[model samples]
Target: MNDFERQLQELFNEVKSMIMMGNKNDAIDLLQANYEAVNEQINAGNKGIEEVAILDIIALGYMYIGDLKFVQSLLDMMSGIVDSLKDDEPLLDAILLHMGSMYSTLENYEKSMLVYQRVINVLESRYGKTSILLVTSLLGMAKVLGSIGRAKKAVEIYHRVITILELNRGTESADLVLPLFSLGSLFIKEGKAVDAESVFSRILKIYTKVYGENDGRVGMAMCSLAHAKCANGNAEEAVELYKKALRVIKDSNYMSLDDSIMENMRIDLAELLHIVGRGQEGRELLEECLLITEKYKGKEHPSFVTHLLNLAASYSRSKNFVEAERLLRICLDIMTKTVGPDDQSISFPMLHLGVTLYHLNRDKEAEKLVLEALYIREIAFGKDSLPVGEALDCLVSIQTRLGEDDTKLLELLKRVLRIQEREFGSESEEVMLTLKKVVSYLDKLGRKEEKFPLQKRLSNLRMKYKQKVQY
Candidate 1:
């Protein structure tokens, strides 16, 4: 090793010794004190492999101390040197990985992906395919893809990385846990709940063996498993799992308690409870979550908007339409400013607000808002989507309450039924519900012939459902 390398080694030894002696504050101070001198030396023509080594050591020190701002500054400085070290491929790769990680930490996922792809290309050229060195870049790419809503692509990449790690390491390797967890989450997003359940079960097993059953990581896995269970229509089991997860989080030491995680889990549990008819309990939990979220995450944060909307839903369930409308209006204002008027994110709040308004006897305003939400949902998800069907139902309800001419309401009901049939098939519960609405509207319009066909279809679907359930 050269002079810079020798110095870095000494610093590393000193920092490690300080940590061993429980003098982490002193170690951080020493690293901070030496950082500027190292940078000045590099500026004064000492920019070699050892200079890069020194920078990496300093960056690691900042990371150890959890000072991400300093870590970002050090990575930015290293980025300027990375291009000049083209001949030093390994050093270039390391610097690029550091930069990518910093970018990811800052939520600049697009830039993170660009840097990670470059690292992947360099590693592939240097070491060929199947190299363990490609693992980090692959993992980063998968994460960026998932963040950007490319769930299928993210799943593919995650599986590829898992296969490589399992082959190069072992089936039970710790490295497989993260990818498994990510894959499970992606599966859930894609509505593959059975697949998600399988992946999360594996993760739960791994966490149980490695970290013990009561670890917070195990709680996370259990929460995910609970989501899958809920999706699979086992609400009681899901409720139990969610409660168990919360218990693990509650039992954790105070310093180890993650407020954001705890709040999110509580919100999820509340939603499940509401779905299972425990509206009072669910509403109380939602109110608690909303308060905590507003206190820490701030009222304007996206997560705060989510909590507000969820609480509004609970209020709506409890027939507290006035409070529901107030909360939903706040959510709409925030969403409009953050995501713009026409974004798909605005649709849910608009629809909920419209429903609340309709309940409060404001049909005209409710109709306008519901129409806007319908337009947005149709543009984002097409006319035949489930969301569009829901929007149509809202419009139908508003028009019916206004006592409008039966023609338009009847046509709207028919359209909703068609959309449901296309999306869920004629035998599904969604189609059955839409068919009933269509029959009611047709009968009110004195179109007995039109009602006859829908009535027959509903009867057949109910019989089919009963037969399946009985068997």
Candidate 2:
């Protein structure tokens, strides 16, 4: 072998040695040592395994180790090879898409977004926007964006994908289910259960008829249904659906399962387990989910935060307050540092922390945290936002426990009802449910003079919803 080939082979051996010796830092250093040398080899017009083969192995190394820094270095090394393939659109598109994949691996979604834009710019401009590669690129970018908290943008892109798919195949075609799932996930994140249910229902029908009810995809769709049902406040039904889905997944083919999909299923099933109050099962599943996520995305990632927050809630419910409190505080610190103290993302863990404290009969501290979360959410999502209603509901429940017979409590309940109605429409189940709580508050106060109108409105509302339910 020549100098370049000799150096690459030597470096590869060194990397494997470092990893085997449990000296990852040394492995990174070794990769750093040969970084420029590898680029030189790729540029020196080598056509053997030392160039493309070495580069591919190095990329896989960074990816499998799940180190953001090493993955970035691997990407930077690939840039030289890409620069030489400027006129080769296929190669360029593949390179750009691969960059998107790496950024996705790191969950650096904004960077992944820019990489996808490059792919779209090169491919669509060169081969026309109607090409199948363009469609796939758009869908892939949408998926990444959705994963990284840009659900609105992802929803828009999913709609465009749906439009393209529909134009090519029409609504009755199996292609509809793909975009339907994307939209369903987008709706789920935003707490739009009704919309999500509709999309998942469509996907379920198509997937069942096309792939059979016993298929893994049918199971996946059932998982989505379970989540939506949970969001709709039907946890018992969600638990049943999850059990059915789990059975199907366990029996069906595992070869088709991707890591991301499997991780999601793990989380969804864990959440359902929690809904059924099987805290032990949920905690075990969440722990396994965390291990897989840590292997794929590393620690201190938002998804890491998500799983921790979720499990902490389970811990609190299982009466393990200390562990729950520790996780919540870490989450609080991370959210404050990353998104700032006032950002809405801080509200979720805080809300749970407050509720957990309340469950432990620590009302005063719970009130403080819950109010802080409510204030932050109101500032971020407006006074009439559903996020505000969520915090308000938490506070109202706490107030009921504290035996606060104050007008402020009633006013807060009224505000929650108004916000839910404003955001989700007056006939929405969430609005009706909030109104039910308000009626309960009035009932406790024995203010029939004030409660009569609410009682009548609720009866009418109940009738309306009951009729809708029956039909």
On TM-score, the leading prediction is 1
Q: Which one wins on lDDT?
A: 1
After the best TM-score superposition of candidate 2, give how far the Cα of residue 198 lies from its true spot, in angstroms: 19
TM-score of each: 0.55, 0.48
Across residues 1-471, which tens digit of lDDT does each residue of candidate 2 receive?
A: 367556655766777878888999887765655556667765687633345446645775666556677677766666555545554433456557767777787777777788788788888778776666677779879989888778888888888888777777776668888778878978988888988988888888888888899998888889888889889888888878887886788689643333667767778778678767787988998888777667778766778788788779788878899899888888788778878888888999999899888877899999999999999988888888888888988998898788877677889999888887778888788877878878887887788898888888888889998999899
The CA root-mean-square deviation of candidate 2, after full C-alpha superposition on the true structure, stands at 11.6
lDDT of 1 by residue, 443-471 (tens): 88788887898789889988888998999
Model 2 lDDT, full chain set: 0.79
Report the C-alpha displacement of residue 457, candidate 1, in angstroms.
3.1
User: Which segments of candidate 2 are over 4 A away from where they belong?
Assistant: 1-258, 272-279, 316-322, 403-405, 443-449, 464-471
The residue pairs that clash in candidate 2, if any, are none
Candidate 1 residue 105 C-alpha distance from true site, Å: 22
- Work out candidate 1's RMSD over C-alphas: 10.1
